[model samples]
Target chain A: MSATFSAQDPRALAEAPPMLSLRGVTKSFGAVEVLRDVDLDVRYGRVTALVGDNGAGKSTVIKAIAGIYTFDGGDYRFEGEPVNVTNPKQANAMGIEVVYQDLALCDNLDIVDNLFLGREITSNGLLDDETMEKRARETLASLSVRTVSSVRQKVASLSGGQRQTVAIARSVLWNSKLVILDEPTAALGVAQTEQVLKLVRQLADNGLAVILISHNMNDVLAVADDIAVLYLGRLATQIDAKSVSHAEIVQLITSGRLDVDSARATTTISTGERSGSESTDQGAI
Target chain B: MSTVTGRDLPGLADAPDKRATTALSDYLAKVRGGDVGALPAVLGLIVLALVFTGLRSDTFPTTFNFANLINQGAGVIVIAMGLVFVLLLGEIDLSAGFTAGTAGAVLGVAVTNHGMPWWIGVIVCLASGALIGLVIGLLVARLGIPSFVVTLALFLALQGVLLQIIGEGGQISISNPTLLAVMNSNLALWQGWVLYVLVVVGFGAVSYRRMAKRRAKGLHAERFSVWGFKFCTLVVLLGIVTFLLSRERSVNVEATSIMGVPMVVPVLILLLVGLTILLNRTAFGRHVYAVGGNAEAARRAGINVANIRLICFIICSTMAAVAGILIGSRDNGVTPNTGGNQTLLYAVGAAVIGGTSLFGGKGRPVDAIVGGLVVAIIANGMALLNQPAGVVYVVTGLVLLVAASVDALSRRRAAATGRF
Candidate 1:
């Protein structure tokens, strides 16, 4: 695939405000390039949907952002300042939390424990159970997640949806300003998908920037504020959710090339005006 | 794996505003959570006692026999207490036997040879054990060697050292008056019984108060009936033990005031209690579980996994050393072969039988005590029956098998139930 990016125009886009941004991100596994010149942005209170075909670098982008992997040629910026995230702990320290697909929960531990995990609050050299359980319950309640009866219930006893909620809640619980979710609704039933989508939207509405990596187009459409489509190793386009339709995004996902003629034809500039537009577009065609 | 039933966690979320509970309530919550695993063991003890009583009739119920049982069981119980922590992390400490032997030899050198104060020698013994633990921890964590290998090496090396220390002699007899006094002398029978009662009651009371605090703070309690039942059972058991030890000297026996029970019993009990609290209540304890449960996960969570493992090995080795010293003190001497043969086997067996999973992350110091008692009882009972040492070994092996098999089966069932 050709590098369709206009190099000069990227400087202007680079100046745009970003809550979290990756510039010139490049990743390679041996000789295969997974992510090449990938530039992405997430704005505060906005859900940026990262959609791509399998192996289209969605995971690479998310992992780099979450500090699961270090990209070779990228400047990662949080709040428009450059930062190097060497590990997940570093990412967490910088207010970046990643909720992976498996959720990484201890089945034997209760909701409060899973939420706190490694960051348990203790006093007098002992686990402060009361304070932890209290904070856990309050956090869940604040998130409006009422499906579960209590925070002390073990995560193993929860349904898939409730587990997802716990996972997401845990990532966003402690001073998090950015949350990255990978395949949040991949295995969920209809009701569960609805619950998780609501949570994603809720997270963004709560003033946190959310980077949602999903393969489900419909789910993305339901929760995303701005949809960024990645084709091959490069980001093809990012369109306002209000301006794009599911079918148009799907075309961008499958073919990488936009059907400009069809998009223009549907906009109703008139048949005679369309003919006039084709005359100007003839040189490029 | 038992499936996690929602019913198992009843009222976890229903408790409204538990954080507002008093300090007493908070303490209660912790005690309640810690004691959840002890009920089954307690029940097993009662049933076993009743069954043995029924089967042996005259022999099992004899007062002399009961005292003998406590005396013989005390040493093993101490060893098991230390082994429990090692097992809790799903690790084993094979060196405990040799570690104990080494400590015993050191005590011999300190008291008999150097004429050090018994107290100073005791301190040195414990310090030596802690140092062994530290070495084992470093080997396992920093050197990236497995604990089994590290401990096994220590076990062999320590055994050799103990033999050399004994200098071809089979035993190092203790002649220190103070040391002998501790091992052989006892308070008035009634006084000893009273002291035991007070200690047991004190702990039970602390446990009760802690549980009550947790309940007040809106944390889950192990059913109100369960806590009451546990408390009542403990009281009854303590009463029986104290009563048994308080029995009058045999009618024909000369000293009507058969001095108080051996000091080993209380020391063993205290060690078990202290270790249990340390394993379950402290941040270090939690880190141990985290590392055992999943080292990678623990590391990702910002825990220093290597450091936790290192510390655990150190603790385990140190405990082993303490156990050795206790054994030597109880016997009033140290021997070249004191900790060889079945010592490691029994330590591991006691730990396994006590219900600490070989898989780690789910066990307690109490389990080790129970398991050690079980082993000691078997040994004492066999000796009473005039069974040979070989027979005792076979029986112990079978008992260990049974314990391990039962644990495996129960865990498998728990997993199936999704209660993991």
Candidate 2:
């Protein structure tokens, strides 16, 4: 990365600048240091997967980025400009949106209402239902999400995958530059998972940076262009998805250590037994 | 970035309500699926009206009784309408009855003893109700006290305040002609017709424009024929009421002519329209539903849930103030028991009977009116049958129980079907 910018505004920097970059971020709860010196980079039009074991500070990293919990120490930068977002509203203003695991959707409301819960379109102090309904449908269509019948259907009647679609669609509804999805496909079925992963890919394809946090290795490897692994509140490695094997990721996740020789040896055995049909779109790469 | 799939899955059951026979069948499907809405209340109202008419044909079916029913039920209906807000948040205000009583007492003391004008007394009364609601809201929203406990405490405390306002065993006769005119007066025949015309035209225009807008967008909107039917029904219902009310209903037309629609009808109608619009077409209303449905989700969505709860409580109490004034107007005096005894229960009964779910996140101002009529018709019919107040209470309680059962049962059915 260059040290100097040609443009006056850091936000107007050249094409190579990261959409968001965090360096040496640390957080503590009382005497316990939950996260220590974590560095991560998210780029425009790419899906960066953040993977870690339970209690390895995956949520902490996300919370810090989402501005749910302020990091004790960090250089939190967005578009090369140092930022100190103290609340979720500020993060949203900086074009950062997080789709939590719970989706935070009201079951009693319809898809359109849920999508624009707090931010309703109004004219003359009255709800502009037609305008909101039109935009909601367009947003869904843009994501190629046709799993639900109508935008007016209540969320309570929607399937798990459809709910996830609505939740993801809600995040992208605003002009967000970065979206952090926590376990997007954690509770979906086989067919639904494929639909969601493609959606994740489509998000990046649409020029929005996406950070996907998941425990599923297949999902991580299948949808992520770059994988940033965290171990024990610290950065284990940030590597290209193509450069790492399944066993290598497993090793990094478990021990927070790298053994290139052993990883290369297990690749042959792992690839031989893995189903080729399951990886058709992935296999082309 | 990697293995991409979707937009090609044949497994999705994504069928829009775009199929043939969907208009009728879809309604049937929803009804079967436990979303019966206000049908039960309407049917209950119809059945009760018929039974009461059959029991006391000469007295019950008369136009005078019809007008009487409207006046008698207006107070409870308005109170119930206010309760709808608190009820929408899945909260209750048992103190609503006493809140009305307290407001009535305040109005009485202000106008009678203090020589305040009727409007000033009204403003003071409404303010007191709002203040009482604020206290309840603070305990429930800010302090996290359960609404039932806080309102229950207020219910007992407000009665003492009521007794103190009018004094123990003291009753203040409200001789302010303007205030008394609210329940005892009637609009002239021309005025009634004019009001009816305004209502029907206003309703038709709004509905037609909304439908036109939706249709213009190529979105799902009711068919013209369907809209026509609904519009025609409204016209017929209002026309019949106005036509009937315009006739002379006085027992002795020589001395007094008590014809035309009661003044209370127009007031109730105005309240109904305003509150309906407030609940359905406003951001604040949506937030109330959202918070009621899932407070955690609403909180995450950046909605101030506590504020919504606090406001709803205030609305409920303010409504209680209006109902109290109606009661005082009807009785021509303010008494300690103006909003005491079965007043709150009847209002709650009327709300539930109108199909406002006690479980929350469902109801309308119209529901209160419908439920109020049901309660009023029963009382009126039973009184014509020479039934004691005790018997009337028992019967109303039973009907309320039936309405509640329908609500709970329909919810279960809806859940089972919603899961499908």
Candidate 3:
């Protein structure tokens, strides 16, 4: 696996114009603050892995990114300009697609219908189902998901892995600029997991920035170029995968203890960058 | 002993390539309790006919008795057609009986007491019924009240209004000669039978052609053999009914001059066919089913569920009003008791027994007519047997329960097995 480095200054890296960037993102549910002053950068043609343990606020961060839950404070910038993602539709309109864990598909509907659901193509005020089905076939083929025989088949008839493939293909079909996949291989068989990981790598190689959230350390190591660990709603450390060992990442994720060398590595990479002076040690559980 | 394609073949008569055919045959075999409710209703009618024939011997099979069945079934058929639309949306209209009565009473006053034209009065009455239906629908949809509660209130309120409209006079007789002549007119024997045949043929052709077109487009098409069989059977069955009615004593009294079937039978038949198409083929119809099947899912799919529901209520109420005018015209007048309490029961019972699911998402106007005939046959048979009206109620209730139980069981099985 190849690792990515931001090169001595995270703020300077931001000045280089990321494909998408989040700055000063904070979220709270009622009285409980979940995400505290978090910042991240996603550049074109790179797979950025967001890894954390359970209750590390990874889901809340992704949900915030997906517009499932709004943030209390944040600056979301796309292509060097600030943008506001107030809802799923707004996020979609801005070319940011989130393929969540559930996929939110209607099983009774066929693949073409599910792919174009809520915004089906219409001609003369009636559904242009023929054109939609043709486009759906092309989209799946573009993703190299060849297991399906007919796009007209109902989703209920599909296997679990095929369903996931269809969902990923749906997001990509819309020309998304950034794709956030939540636990893409969480419930898959070994072979299916391999298929999804391959698809994820291919997605980044296709020039779109990818944000992969997974608890599987090995899978993340296999595909991610950069890894950001969050411990108890705070960013513990962000490091290049090639520079950090699996044991160091586990420690940083679970204990918030950046071993001497790994801490130096973070300082060396983000050297003159403004460090978020928040208490990462508060979540040292 | 029968092992041609396999070693110890177990009922595998055809090759593996014939699986689609086998599946279709299995579906057809389950038609009585299949996804379509029409099968069981048809079966119930046959069983009821046999039981009645057995009980009354010659009287039940007589031409006069059969004509009486048609006469009694016509009003109920019209009202039940209206109920099917309401029930298809998983809603209920309890005020149909009273709505019919109120509309009839108002029309009666306009035509008889105020000397207004019959046609104008009927239009006003239907509009009134439609307005009431809209109000009830709005209350149910907007206020989030249950449909049963909303309609029940309408039922009680309309009953009071109907009584007040009729006043202490108790009855209002129509003196409109043109209206009476047109509504009471029947076709001559041969002409009546011809009209029924033409209607059944016309309706069957339209249905089959549309279904075939849908099938060709890779959409669902009912089994061709089943569709053909149903259409042919209906034509023959209607022909027999017309023949029976033509042999009645009234025909001989008119010196065989009026050889056709009653005008109301064709009218009811046309209305049932029209409503069935309106509910099945339109986008609005699909939205209604979606709303009833799963409201949240329908909303997420961007359907205007509330608007669909409101339109359904208006259709149901307007249909009831139409039925009311027809019934009043047939009886030559309207009274405070024109649409009695039994009318509501008969209308709802017809819809339920005909295969309209009380749970919604499944129903047809044609099923309502079949259910209406079932109720009418029971009443006619009981009267012929000199049995009490109470017996008719018991039998009808038992049939309704059977139909509802069958529907519930079928739905549960469909959910479990994931068939159509």
Candidate 4:
């Protein structure tokens, strides 16, 4: 659907344009405010894990980023440029995709069909099955997906892990620059979780900005390069995942503060400066 | 025609097509995998056929009865074909029977009362059917009303529309010669054979072209042997049907010699092929399945699911109109009872019996044709044996129940195997 399988160099990503930066993003439903003054920064070649407690506005932030909800007030920037995305289609058109936790996949359709669901390739008004099949195979192969035997196997016949992989792969299929995943591992087994988390890291490693929302701090700490925590409808801090500990993330999630009134306390966004634990998490991913 | 019959040998390694033995085993494995596409319908047809062949019907064994079976089943088959669209969307059109009746009444009124040409009447009838479908579709897709409830309301309302069209004449006897011929006439014996040849050759040409195209792309195509066997089997089927239909079906050879395939056969075939292509080959068809399987997913994929649902309803009511006209032409009149659940239930039964999943996203138009045959045979055989209408209804109902059971149980089996 895009130009070919071109991945930007991870090393060059530091100098690359910023993928998505939200400044003072606010959302409300009638009288109740869900999110207020939320500042989030997602960069290329990095997984920004957006972890929060239940109803801590993590979903609201994701929906807002995916253009499922309109921000009551905010500046939504894409690739260092300002743009208003009022719908999911606009987000998709801007190379932004949100893979919801429910995994919005048609079980009756095969991998190829599912991948090209609304955007089927047509020649002479008929589905160009061969071309689509070839591209699906190429994409899956590039992702090193081996669990699936055939591209024609229906989504229903796939394991939870494979389905998750297909869902993730679909976002990249369209040359997406920023992907927001919501609770991807909540229903998956441990092995599938590992597989998904790896796929998530690979997305970032391939120079795409990835936003992951999960309740599990372990998953967030293991693969994320920048972990953004939200608590009580506000972003507490966006810290370098490498610099932060699992307890720090948990503390932020619970209390909406990284540290007690000392250094690196709150509302500070950190960069990917590696640490002792960060290298191990990188290897695990 | 079956989408379930394929191997998934991972990446670029194109799995070679299996031989006949492997193909057979593969089919068995597919059945075990809860993808029993049309097996039940085929087996049901055979069982019903063998039982009726030696039963009390003097005409059931005749070539005339064989031809009669086609005519008797054509209307239901067409309706069922249309129903496949709605069913594929996991939606129901309960008013389809009456929609057909209302549309047929429009034709009858246009031609018989207003002295319009048959073609104009046909257009008017079809448009009316489209309008009816549009209304039902709007209610379901736009208003977010359940299709079952919306159609049920139309089912009652359309009956009144038909009654209003009949205008206390009690019935409208079709006077147009062309309209009458749709159900009463037949193709010449030579024409039937020529059509058969053309169909076979066309199928071979289309299939081989597709295979060659895939091969050109360095992609796996169905094996020549596998496709050859399928072609041969289809040819044999058409050959038998043409040969059987070409025989002298009239009691007296001179008066009304019905010795060719009925015109309805071609009509049925045209609908079958067109709808099949629409479903299996087109983007619209693919989107329909997507919407049915998971609408939220389809919406995220930027598919206009509501539009798809609306179109499917339109197709259903329009096909139902065609069926109504066919039945009206066959009966030579549009009576008050011209459209009823007797037909809708049979068409639904035919669809389900042929393995078109009521749950949607797992059906083909061919399923309707096969299932229609099973329903027709049951009805025809029961009629020939001097069985009352009650028996026919009961038997048909039981058959549908069994088919639905198979569907539900297989769905469960599929879920157990993670095909859910």
lDDT string, candidate 4, B1-420, tens digits: 011112332444555343567677867977898888999899999989989987855778788999899999988998999999999999999898898889889989999999999999999999999999999999999999999999999989998988998987799989788999999999998999999998999999999999888877666667788889899999999999899999987898777778898999889889988998999899999999998899899988888888999999999999998998898899897988887759999999999999999998888899999999999999999999889999888988999999999999989888777664
Error of 1 at B32 (Å): 20
How big is the positional error of residue B5 in model 2, measured in Å on the Cα after superposition? 24
Q: In model 4, how large is the Cα lDDT of residue B50? A: 88
- Please compute DockQ, using alpha carbons, for every candidate against the native two-chain complex: 0.24, 0.27, 0.11, 0.40
Candidate 4: C-alpha lDDT: 0.84
Candidate 3 residue-wise lDDT, B55-84, digit = tens:
988778766666557767777788888888
lDDT of 2 by residue, B1-420 (tens): 112232332323333224435667878888898887778989988998889888888999999999999998988999999999999899999999999989988999999989999999999999999999999999999999999999999999999998888875589878899999999999998999999999999999999999889777656787777777789999999999999988899999899989888988888988999999988899999998898778888998889999999999999999999999999999998888889988999999999999898888888889999999999999889999999989998999999999999989988987787621
Docking class of 4: acceptable
Ranking by lDDT: 2, 4, 3, 1
Task: Give TM-scores for every candidate, taking all chains together and pairing residue i with residue i.
Answer: 0.84, 0.92, 0.75, 0.92
TM-score of 1: 0.84
Q: Which candidate is the best by DockQ?
A: 4
lDDT of 4 at A193: 92
Over 4 Å off in model 4, which ranges?
A1-17, A28-33, A258-285, B1-20
Model 2 clash pairs are none
For candidate 3, write residues A1-285 as lDDT tens digits: 101322224334334467777777899888898988777778666778999889888999877777778878878788789877777677777778877786555554567766775566765655565556556765665555656766766565576677787778778777787889999888899888888888787677666678999999888999887788888787776666676777777877888656576454543334224354245666674
Global lDDT of each candidate: 0.72, 0.85, 0.73, 0.84
**TM-score of predicted chain A against the true chain A, for each candidate:** 0.86, 0.87, 0.86, 0.86
Q: Give one digit per residue, the lDDT tens place, for model 2 in A225-277.
A: 87887887777767668778887888878877555477675332232232321
**In candidate 4, which residue pairs clash?**
A149-B10
Given the true complex, what DockQ would model 1 score?
A: 0.24
